[model samples]
Target: MQKNHHFSYVIGAILILAPMLAQAETKDINQTKFSKQYAGWAATIEQTESEDMLATYPASVILWAGSTFSHQYNSPRGHKFAVADASHSLRTGVAIPPGGNGKSASCWTCKTPDAPRLIKEMGEEGFSGSNFVDLGPEIKSVIYCSDCHVDGTAKLALPRPHAQNAMAKIGLPFDEQNISMQGAQTCGQCHVTYYFQPENNNKVNMPWIFGNTADAIEKYYDTRRFYEWIHPISKTPMLKARHPDFEQWSRSKHADMNVTCITCHMPTVTDKNGNDYTDHKVSGALIHFDQVCAGCHKSKAQLTATLERNKAEVDAKSRQVQNLLVKAHYEAKAAWDGGATWPMMNEGIMGIRHAQWRWDFATASHGMYAHNPKEGLALLNKAIEQVSAARDVFKQVSSQVGAAKPVYPDISTKAKAQAAIGYDEPAAVKAKQAFIKEEIDKHWHPVATTGY
Candidate 1:
């Protein structure tokens, strides 16, 4: 018993110091080293293009009411830019003031590597009480080793509470030994359609109570009477769809084939010395297509062409939904402006709500085109049907109003669109800059200099 106890003690000590010990030998490499090791693939990686899908649309359809911070509807880039992107985005940064940004410390939960430690120290309630600016100082590391690991082991763990809720809702039979599921579930920690439940508390919640489909998610939110914001002009309750990557990607061909996200996005590569390990620098599979696609597809050119074809088809359909949604919002606003009340246009309002929900589901699910193009296009068609019905309702209500035609505004750019929605872009930018300078820099700069 004494011998066994001493052996156990020695093993435990080594386990405790494993991360520190490993850092000396197998530390995460810098971008330069990474590029060299990755055969210059990292160098070709591009910053995610900045896009504002809403900027071109009318403010009535773009901006959410009662949100102090404005969100830019940009697609995510490589994980390397995680912190840089969040810190600069108006959605996360504008909410930095003591009570102004209209966001809680919970906002930082998925954005930082130190989330587990911060949550442990503050407790979930205390964390929610704090502001993004106050918590910004503590979150120095971007999404890194600590976010999903305990002492840098291959063993996976989930750090975010919302993911836990989602897994429970979906009735995912827990299996501690299933590392593949764990790896995939860990990705779900951030990559799903989620909303902050309470306005102030901001406890992350997935609309998975009903189901995971586009319609099912909308049904869940509708039953709960949840609305991210009411369209200021249209007067219809609206829900902003966040990235629904996991939901859309699940059960797709790749998923059905048991090709988890880690299998592609984090594919294992052999070093010059023939040591094999999964790459930790997560990015799009296409960025390192040779490494990922070469496992199955022989010709990279053919694979690239196939992906592009699917994406183009999906984008074309998504654009149709976007146009239809714009028309619906404007028509709905015209009806409201023409003195159409909820009592009179309840059915029409519901149509607009559900239609836009479908549109957002297809549009918001990152890489939905590649994951499941058929479903993506189908969702868009359903949205078109619903939005067309909404337009019909507006026509019916048009007889009661003075204006015969919907007054379309000249919202050609982001500024115009924001102005139409009563958004103060300058104010948001100023608040974000102030927060970064006064609060975020105190911690962000130090670690940034020392290097992530």
Candidate 2:
């Protein structure tokens, strides 16, 4: 193991005990069951995911870089590795020319508690365009007590401006007076979809100006003509979806029954002393299904099988769309290469852009397969329609160019597809390793003792 991770190791160890922490009039941010000691457990959960987190980045993401996740994407390791992971990710500011705009400090906004604190101290605009490397030492910790706590006391707080601003736009506003909203808002801080608003100092903002569903947010992005990048092959301007767990959960049946994420992910755990506190491991609810859902469900076995079935069905539908979507990108590239003009290509490219956005938005929530499979399948249906429309446009261009049939290139594997788009996997891997050693281990966030 690398040295100088003393604090990280401490939290890593406590997470093994299944941590329990924090509460108030907020029964559990109701703050009903929280004590400082217990809150450390919450901090521990915040600090580490305490499970094997490596190599779980989805295999189907062969076309990953074409979307928002960019060069590299992985299953998120909990807060303990937040700073390190960001530094190590090939997606974050690697290979940028000096003075060119790479990812800004705004990219770090959700990864560390230090971000909000620094944003408050330096002003959001002041922090926005700053270099990611320059902010490392100051941001030397992951999500912890301070991210959601007020002062040194245990009173729950809202530190994320993105969450607060987004909530207000939805008309609920920031009312600490309402503990239920407060509890969910804590998770919502980083769990919702957001885009960096270039009009507003590159500060992060949610795409909920119109509403919460996948298409509503798409309409919102449309109003602004906001997009992340052009697909290298298709030349389509595209929008990248971030995780939208909070948004999907709000529309879930669980939400209708007054269940928040904490009721499941942070279920109450009783100690040997017979006192109950929330589990701080912060794992998937399905990991310990009985702990959270056993009270309501009659047969744990049947429920587990049902949830898994839901996930499999969503995954199958998504994969089918993904195969078609990948084909559309290459097909658009063929049209461009054949000297198809914008008039002929615009419709095709737009179709690719819209189709991919729906897929990214729907599947971005890892839990959507189980938590809101209906919504997931619905958005995917739209993806199918959009990609098919894109293909129709591509076919018209192909025929007009005297190339009646566009032969699909053989990009059946990730390596082939990446090469088709001019990405260098080996170089990217090398750069990420070098960056982690020189930047992360030597100069990035040092784990905090208080995190445990």
Model 1's TM-score against the true structure? 0.83
What are the per-residue Cα lDDT tens digits for candidate 1 across 1-452? 99999999999999999988887777554433444334423422354555565553434235344453244655566555566666667776543334465557777777676766776787766677677656666767766655666544545777776787688788873344277777888887888888876754776678898888887888888888988877765678887777787887786877787778888877887878998767765657887778767777888788889889988887777667766666677787777777777776888888888887877777777778777777888888988898888888888887766545777665667677677667787887787777666665655645322211
Top TM-score prediction, candidate number: 2
Q: What lDDT score is found at residue 319 in candidate 2?
A: 79
Q: In lDDT terms, how accurate is model 2?
A: 0.72
Alpha-carbon shift of residue 166 in model 1 (angstroms): 1.4
TM-score for each candidate, following the candidate numbering: 0.83, 0.84
| Alpha carbon lDDT at 214, candidate 1 | 84
lDDT of 2 by residue, 209-266 (tens): 8888888888988787887876666788878888898888888888888788878877
Q: Model 2, which residues run further than 4 Å from truth?
A: 1-68, 94-98, 404-412, 448-452
Error of 2 at 204 (Å): 0.6
Candidate 1: give the clashing pairs. 95-101
